[model samples]
Target: MATQPVTTRIVLASRPTGKPVAANFRLEQETVRDIGEGEVLLQILYLSLDPYMRGRMDDAKSYAKSVEIDGVMEGGTVARVVGSRNAAFKPGDIVLSHSGWQSYAISDGSALRKLDPDAAPITTALGILGMTGFTAYAGLRNIGKPKAGETLVVAAASGAVGSAVGQIARIFGARVVGIAGGAEKCDYASREFGFDAVIDHRSSDFASRLEAACPNGIDVYFENVGGHVWNAVFPLLNDFARVPVCGLIAHYNEEPSISEGHNQLPTVMRGILRRSLTIRGFIQREFVDQRPDFYREAAQWIAEGRLKYREDIVDGLENAPEAFMGLLEGKNFGKLIVRIAQ
Candidate 1:
């Protein structure tokens, strides 16, 4: 009998209380089972680290189940099939699979989508050409309903999702204003993603700056970071404005705080009533019907130079924990992905 292959992987060591620390995750080696009928053996190449993963780390009830203790951490991965018992895939075939934070996985071919290296870089499967991009497309088209000449605002503007949101809104003939931390990200959002204006949310005068940037007020606001950024966009929301609530990264790791005027709930409700705002919260899977359309159009935009995507790649799977900690602090410049294999 031959020895089974060993795969290196990371798993949840403990549920985090506040911000996650390295102690929350454990790196270990496990045996890879021999290929079973209809299964493919994959070597993970890239693993996406997203803000929503933070929520999954907790044992709280959410749209998705929490990662069990000592279980593999959940995420999307781009991988290459190393061995296969399925006719749909072959050795050396690349694929997009949700194999989580691991070096290898045995997939049953049901949840795997083959990727063509010729189409675009494989890393894009974990980012721009995949779920994040679909998130931006679906949120804007379905819930936001951007209109020509309307001012559309997006927080976390330099991210994979937010950048796409800004560009797509602009393509819809809407004026786009982006809010991001620091001057560098603001410049990139304005210059690279075609945002009409960009505001630095880190500034002491962030609210005032946001007000100044959106002279016509915000007609469509993409809410991804729901702390002070939402506070600034609140009062500036135009009558009948549409808001699509995406992942609130800012509040993901911390408990929601109560502040001035009993915090933002009263203000949010007031704006909703006074302006007749339409605020809809969504999980990307709800709009999976539009995936084919998003892929066709987003690819066209990428090829035509109308859309720009960026990635911040961390070199090793061993570094995923550190990189993820930085992600919570807004240290990553673009889509954060961990390179687990060559």
Candidate 2:
């Protein structure tokens, strides 16, 4: 008889008060149950840790439902089918799944997308070739609408989504300026990702540096890190400039309530009114219709050496919480992934 599998998982131990600590999560193991007809068993290979997972930790309402207390922390993963009762799957297939932070998972064919490892590394299924890349493409095509010779700015410029956003905008003929949190990331964004200019958000004179970088004004601003970055970019947005409000990692750890000291609604409203700005917040799923086009074009760009990406991989499932906490602090250099298994 074959040995049965076991799954190790991290669950939310409690809703976080502010920045999530390791105490907020608990790890447990369970014997894997046999798969029923139409179900497949998966051994997770990689787990993606993105900034938006912070919002899911809160009890507050948003675009998606909050993960219930003690539920597995939500995430996207790449896995290998270890066993299968589903007619459409086999024991050796690689797939993309929403398997959360677990070492293994059970899936019905419904939620698994088969992956071609020969075409790209299976890990890319959780990063560049997956939702992260799609988010950048959809936001640019549908909202930012970058035109040739226009200037575009993206915050967190060396990140999974922001890197893709800057590169795609450049491919569309926009002049791309990136804002990153450190000198290292700033240099990588400009040197590796091909941003026309890169600004270090941590610089003392960040606002003035940003203004100097985009002398013609910003035609598009991909909003990822908000707060101070938004403040600097607001005054530079040209009339009718497009702002795609994506993940706001800068404020994710704060208490949900707005503080009286930082209220800038009046100034923001006045700016919007004066400039006729088109600021739109979007969830990537809303642009599902463009996924095929995105996959085709992004793959072509990667093949042509016009687009690039990087990964910051941690070695174990146990380290996810710490790695995630660091991600919010801008400590991650690229797409953050936890390699759960070989």
Candidate 3:
């Protein structure tokens, strides 16, 4: 007799009205059904928690569909195949799939990518060597177009995406300036990541400090956190500057009442016109064709000691909701991943 398998998962209990709370998520468990043809049962090992997931939580329409109520919160995972009906996959095969916030899932082998633990850490498939790194590579290379001797500014310097963007820009011989929220993050961005300069965005003199840091003006501004960071960088954009609009995390949880007061779109337009700036917004998937190149180059950079990465792992599936809440509050450091199972 085949033994039944059970899986633990988290679902979106309710759409958050503001910053998400613990009540917004619910923990549940279900027995895994027998795998049918071309199906593989994945036992998730790691779950990635990204800032962008916050945008997906909203009920309003956006780039992706909202996670329906009672639906498993969507996310990427690194998992091991424990049961397989697919000819291409075997038991114990480590693979990458969109398993969301679950301890186990059934994948039909439609869009599964096999991962080799020998080449890089399996966790890299969830972060640096995966979506987070690719996001930095595709966005900066295609849009930012940074050049040697130019200055590049990135908000949230210690984060997964921002950190990658700055490090890659340095490889291009660009002066990298990172803006982080506190003294510790600023230190990490400078000492560990090799950023040319670090600015504490929480300081009262943040704008002037940023100006001093970029004496040549900013040739590329990676726009991850909008709002005040945008305001500070707007005037310092060198002529024909490129701004890659990535995650606008600063306004992610903005209350409409307070958010409605920002009438700076006109000012932003005026700056764009006067400076002839080249602003481009990009989603990581748009550069899917370049994934191979991304993998090769990024891996080489890591091997050559030009690239580095960090992870903040939280243990257990039940804690994903609390950790995710902390992610939005900027309580997490480095690439946030939940260790669901061994």
Candidate 4:
């Protein structure tokens, strides 16, 4: 066999205090390790960039461990098995693996799921048919529980999870109201994702506009970007409303000390007590047992035209840092994926 070339990877240069800068990541090349028994060499094709990644940048304790300094940044990737010492996989087989920000990886077949590229675009293993989509489904189904004719409001409405939330809510016969950062994204949500209405959070009249959109009041609030959106949506929630607290990308870059408006907790408690509302926070892994069912249902929905998805793919491993930074700023219009290899 010919000698394998070195693999290039982006490593964590330093932990960021807030918004991650490009200097916080470094590119390095290292010799590819020889595959051992039951090991497979994977060439990464697509890497997912998500809001949760911001939490992983910090050394602070979270549901998931943070990426240590000088380590390859952790991520989910769709890769092709280039070489395998195991009988379960072949060289050309595509698999979904936690390969991080590297061009290539060696894995022991644990936690690697073989995928069929012909079923859908292989890149989708990182997005719509994968974690992002599952997050939306599990969060909404378990927490939101939107009913027919009920109003479902979601922030970051054009993003991966939010978009799926809106579409799925619609499929379940709910009226979907989407809140996005700008007019363009708002248009995409309303026009493409079939949201009943779209509210531009950037607008001066946002709160009032959101209230106007949800005449029946928000029965389910899919909380993605917390902060002003949360403040606005709080008052508009109907009695017994469910809030699926999935992400807080808006506050991800902020320090813990930044003071905002006065205490609204008393009023929030009053609302919760009177209305019997439910609020739940979740990580997607909590629902992996539902993956088989989720994929079957979601894939059927997508095939039957009841679901739609969008992707924002940035080419090259070198561009991953910039793409990730843009993701935090809501600069990405869809599921953000970095194309690492052909």
* Top-scoring candidate (lDDT): 2
TM-score of 4: 0.97
Better of 1 and 2 by lDDT: 2
User: Residue 89, candidate 2: how far off, in angstroms?
Assistant: 0.2
Q: Model 2 residue 110 lDDT?
A: 99
lDDT for predicted candidate 3 compared with the true structure: 0.92
Give residue 286's error in model 3 in angstroms.
0.4
Query: Once all C-alphas are superposed, what RMSD does model 3 give against the true structure?
Result: 1.1
- TM-scores for every candidate against the unseen true structure: 0.97, 0.98, 0.98, 0.97
Candidate 4 off by > 4 Å = 255-261
| Per-model root-mean-square deviation over C-alphas | 1.5, 1.2, 1.1, 1.3
User: Compared with the true structure, what per-residue lDDT tens digits does model 3 show for residues 1-342?
Assistant: 278789998999988887888898999989988888889999999999988888888888677898999999999999999988899999999999999999999999888999999999999998999999999999889999899999999998999999999999999889999999999999998999999999998999999999999999999999989978888999999999999988888778776764677588898899899999998888899899999999999999999999999999999999998898888777899999999898
Error of 3 at 204 (Å): 0.9
**Compared with the true structure, what per-residue lDDT tens digits does model 1 show for residues 1-342?**
257768999999999878899999999998998988998999999999999999999888899999999999999999998988899999899999999999999999999998989989999988889999889999999999898999999988998889989999888899999999999999988888888889899999989988998888889999998877887888899999999998888888785452334555777788799999999989889998899999999999999999899999999999999999999889999899999889
lDDT of each: 0.91, 0.93, 0.92, 0.90
Q: What clash count goes with each model? A: 0, 0, 0, 0
Worst 10 residues of 3 by lDDT: 253-262
